[model samples]
Target: MKTLGRVLTAMITPFHADGSVDFDGAVALANHLLDNGSDGIVVCGTTGESPTIANEDKLTLFRRIVDVCGDKGSIIANTGSNDTLRSVEFTKQAAATGVDAVMAVVPYYNKPNQKGLYAHFKAIAEATTLPIIVYNVPGRTGGKIIPATIEQLHRDFPNIAAVKEASGDVNVASEIYRRIPTDFMIYSGDDGLTLPILAVGGCGIISVAAHVVGKDLNEMIQAFERGEVTKAREIHARLLPIFDAMFVTTNPIPVKYAVRRLGLPAGPFHLPMCEPSEEEAAVIDAALKMIK
Candidate 1:
C-alpha cells in the first residue's frame, strides 16, 4: 500500500470573477500549495466546493490538476456521491484522469447501515483499479463507516487503501488504526486533530487549513515524526486559532476567503455557498493575522 504522503491540502476550487471554475487559477493554486508545503492536493473535496460543482466541471478540474501537479505532488480526486452507480462511474472517470488516488466519501443523506456502507464502497472499489480513500465524515453524511466495516473492506479489497477519519473521535480512529495493517493508511480528515491523530498512529491529514498554512502543517507533521513532541504540540497549538477560524463558517467559505485575503487566485463562492458573514469575516480576519 502506498501513502499519499502527510500534508495534503484539500484545496479550494478557485473561480473566475464571473464565478466560472477557473482552470488557470486552479493550476496556480496547485503550484502555490506545492511551492509552500503541500505534498498532495485533494482537488475536488468538500473544501473545493465538490457538492456545487458539475460532473463535467469536476472531470475538467481533475484533469487540469493532474496535468499540473500529478508528478510534483499526489493529486487525489473526490469522486464519491450518494449514488453508488454515479460514484462508480465518477471513480472510473477520475482514474482515467491520472489522479494518484480517489477518495470515496461515505454516502451522504441516504445514511447507509454498515452492511450497505460495505456494499456501496465495495461496488466502487470493484469498479476501479485506482487506490481508494474511504472518507467518513458522519457529521456531514449522517452515517458513520465504523471501524469493523472499514476492516472488512480493507480485507475484501486491496484497492480500498485508506480511511479519512473525520468522525472527531480519536479513540475511534485509534481503534481503526490498531485493527488495520501498518500499510493500510489512516489520515485525519479534520485539521484540529492532526497531531492527536498522529499521536495515535495516524499517517497524516486531508486538511482544509493546509490551504492557508501548508508550511506550518507540514512542519508540524515532520516535527512529530522526528520525535519532537513538544515542538509538534507547539506548532499544533499555534495553528489552532487559524484552524478554528478556517471553519468559522461552513468549509470553503471561510477558507476561500482566507486564500483570497492572502492575495491568491481564490475568486468567489458559488451560490448555495456564499461569502462569510460580517462577524465571521471579522473572526477570519483576526485569525489570519496569526499566520505570519
Candidate 2:
C-alpha cells in the first residue's frame, strides 16, 4: 500500500474577480509548493474550498492538476462529498485521471455511525482503482474515521492504503498506528502534529501550513529521518505559532492571504470562503514574514 511521503500541501483555491477558478494562480501555487519542498499536493481539500467547487469544475480541476503536477508531486484528489454516491462518482473520475490517490472523509453535517463510515468508504473503494486515504478531520467533517474502521478497511481492501489523521488526538492516532498493517501509512493531517506523529511512527502530513511554510516542514522531516531529533523539534516548536494562526480563520482563507503576501496572484475566494479581514490578513502576513 504505497502512500505519500513527507509533506503534501493542501492547496488553497484561488479565484478571479468574477469568482471564476483562477487556473493560472492555482498552477503557480502548485509549482511553488513543489519547488519549495512539498512531496505532494492534495488538491481540492477542505482547505482548498472543496465544497464550493462543482462536479464539472472538479473534474477539470483534477485533470488540470494532474497535468500540471506531472510527476513532481502526488496529486491526491479530495473526492469526498456530503453524499456517498456523489463521493464515489468523484472518486471514480479522479481515478480515471490517474491521480496518485483519493482522500475520502466521513460524510459531513448528517453524521453517521461506524458502520455507515465503513460502508461509505467501501463504496468509494469499490468505485476506483486509485488508493483510498480516509481523511479524519472531525473539526470540519463532523465525524471521525476511527482506527478500528481503518484496521478493518485495510484488512478488506488492500487498496485502502492510508489515513490522514487530523483529529488532533495523539492517543487516537497512536492507537491507529498500533493496529494497521505495517505497510499502511498514517499522515499527520495537522501540520503542528507532524514531528510528533513521525516520532510515533507516522509517515508525515498533508499540511495547510505547508502551503506557505513548506521548507521548514521538509527540513523537520529530513532532520528526524537523519536522526537529528533536537533540530527537528526546534523547527517544530517555532512552526507551531504559524500553524495555529493558519487556522485562526477557516483554512484556505488564511492560506490565500499568505499566498497574496508572497506576491502571488491570490485574490477573491468562492462563497462561504471569503478573504480574511484586513486585521486577520495582517496577522497572517506577520507570521509568514517571520518564517520568510
Worst 10 residues of 1 by lDDT: 1-10
Q: Roughly what TM-score does model 2 have, to 2 decimal places? A: 0.96
Q: For residues 1-292, what per-residue lDDT tens digits would candidate 1 score against the true structure?
A: 3689898899999988887899989999999998888999898898899988889999998898888777889999999999999999989998999999999999999998899999999999998988899999989999998999999898999789988999999998899888985778889999999999998879899999988889999999999999999999999999999989988989889999999999999998888999999999999999988876
Question: Model 2, residue 197: what's the lDDT?
Answer: 89
**Clash count (model 1, backbone only):** 0
Question: How many clashes in each structure?
Answer: 0, 0
Which runs of model 1 end up more than 4 angstroms from their true locations?
none
**How many Å off is the CA of 30 in candidate 1?**
0.6
lDDT of 2 by residue, 214-239 (tens): 88899999899899999999999999
lDDT of 1 at 44: 88
